[model samples]
Target: MTDTTTQKGDQMTDAPLLTDRATRLPAGSPDPAEDRSASTGLSVHGLRKTLGGRDVVAGIDLDVAPGELVSLLGPSGCGKTTTLRMVAGFLTADAGVVTMGDRDVTTLGPERRPSAMVFQNYALWPHMTVAQNVAFPLRTRRVPKAQTAERVRAALELVGLTHHATSKPTAISGGEQQRVALARAVVQEPDVLLLDEPLSNLDAKLRVGVRDEIRRIQQRLGITTVIVTHDQDEALSISDRIAVMHDGRIEQIATPAALYARPATLFVAGFIGSASTVAGRFLTGTPATVGADDTVLVRPEQVTLCEDSPLRATVARVLARGHFAEVVLAADDAELRAYVTGPPPAVGSETGVRLGEVLVYRDGLLAEVVR
Candidate 1:
């Protein structure tokens, strides 16, 4: 599984811990020459890690260009986090290599590698002040006091946490603490930044705000980044591309739009977004090579409940979700969901379904159907 491929030019916030979110640099913002990887970008070649007599990461290969934000997304125990750990030099790979530019750091220890990792727990020392916590890494390197202060201040400013620099970790909210962790990671300006579920600590409402802050900082810095998370919405919104892994292997890698619009495999289609798959005859041309009976994968938003539509389904339930209603329909043996505006039809009433974006696939391969 050893393969080497070069990639290039592929691709947060806080305001006062909240202000950066509102004024984040737009996507494709200009990055300084030094922030951009001039000599090397992060690359994983046939990386494998086996533990407990089983392969946790089996022959994985991924390339993240300078300034790109790629998310390793999958359910727990799917090896997304393991892959990030290996890249950070926290875990040794059983096979394959990791390179930053042309330097092979596969055998390097965590501190020896040219990377910084922000842990899931926000690993801030309760004994230290916000400034002190962010400055710990610099102190270890024996950085000059004057330069360290400047860098620390700059980092705190980047995450909009300068005002809370003197406060202890216990004194701030979870969102503010998370920003402190981010500040620590970027204080040294490493070649790559690795985030391991950085937003998991925050509440549901805070998650989106914090997530937006992260994107703002990443875009502003233009540093290569790799994030590990199981949340599809997080990956979809934060990443330049997503690598969906399953069973310790990469199932597919594509931009969020491409992954959702044209999933290469059935697994990717099912994993990345919601859809109701129903097997129906290829009324016209088959999407697959063999022309076998295919399934139509229709998203809930793609479904329109119209009175004049030819295809009808019985309304089983309708759950109002503020802006739209999640209407569940029973069409023959298939149970499907649709998003419709206004009040839902009475339970057991019939409604027509007009599907907008219909994807046809056969034997797990994307195919075109002329229905």
Candidate 2:
């Protein structure tokens, strides 16, 4: 279950590699046979992979429109990175077709495909200067000196590393090193860009800034892109769309707003955002009380504290969360968490829990009980 063949160092937690050959980075210019049009899209159909006799990626199908940035968001061992590797041609699919635009690239090698990947560890050679690292892809193809130098300069400028072009990767900050990795990935002007947990190594504050820079660069390039990350915030902020994966399957895929507001499964509802699940029944009559068969998802930000309400609970804890206070309440043998802006009710005091916005499901998976 340990893969050392891929260039993305420690990028995939413990996924097994079927091959020992490392996926070589793209060299020189894009493939002339590969369409470099603005309309070129990336598609994967019926993709499946097995490692160590276990199915890691099971029948995954995804499509990314040109100029769109999509993220495969999932926790460890969920097969998100495995799927990305297959798309990048680092891992061959056990079953399925990977297509670029109208051509089937299911059997293509990593270097033959019109795609570039930014590795998790920033994969820059420690001995090379920033400009040299960015230009290495061109050098691999033996691109002319003038063209390589010009492309390297443009790539460095795109990632805002122009001033540090002569500096070795070890001389720069972690964030700068990441930008250099990005520059190297995009210097070839590939039709698609792949990012493998591209910001996992940065500090919390730096991740925010670097992620923004990535999104900005992606927009400017207008190339089809796929990013893999376990961080929901990173996925939500940088992606035009996100695919939530679990247990070797895609749970849901949608835009950030839609995914957050209307999660398709209980796993997604709970994973994409914070939620407190309370099991109760749907009242049939007017001003009805909660019954016992249904489960309700109450988002903290949607709940409010109000006086003179039918539903009551005991405040268990109160926490100040910068812009709002998190009030934890015990109600009907379930804990209800609410986010409010005003002073919170004292702990151990009785208060009313408001159901301002709630999603009720009849079954554990797919029945919509209420909106």
Q: What lDDT score goes with residue 122 in model 1?
A: 88
Q: Candidate 1, after superposition: displacement of residue 89 in Å? A: 0.9
Residue 1 in candidate 1, Cα distance off native in Å: 34
Residues 81-159, candidate 1: write the lDDT tens digits: 8888899888888898898766688987766565789987788999999999998976765445665676678788867
Which 10-residue span in candidate 1 carries the lowest summed lDDT? 2-11
How do the residues 43-62 of candidate 2 rate in per-residue lDDT, one tens digit apiece? 98899999988889988989
lDDT of 1: 0.76
For all candidates, the clash counts are 15, 2
Write down the lDDT of every candidate, Cα atoms only: 0.76, 0.77
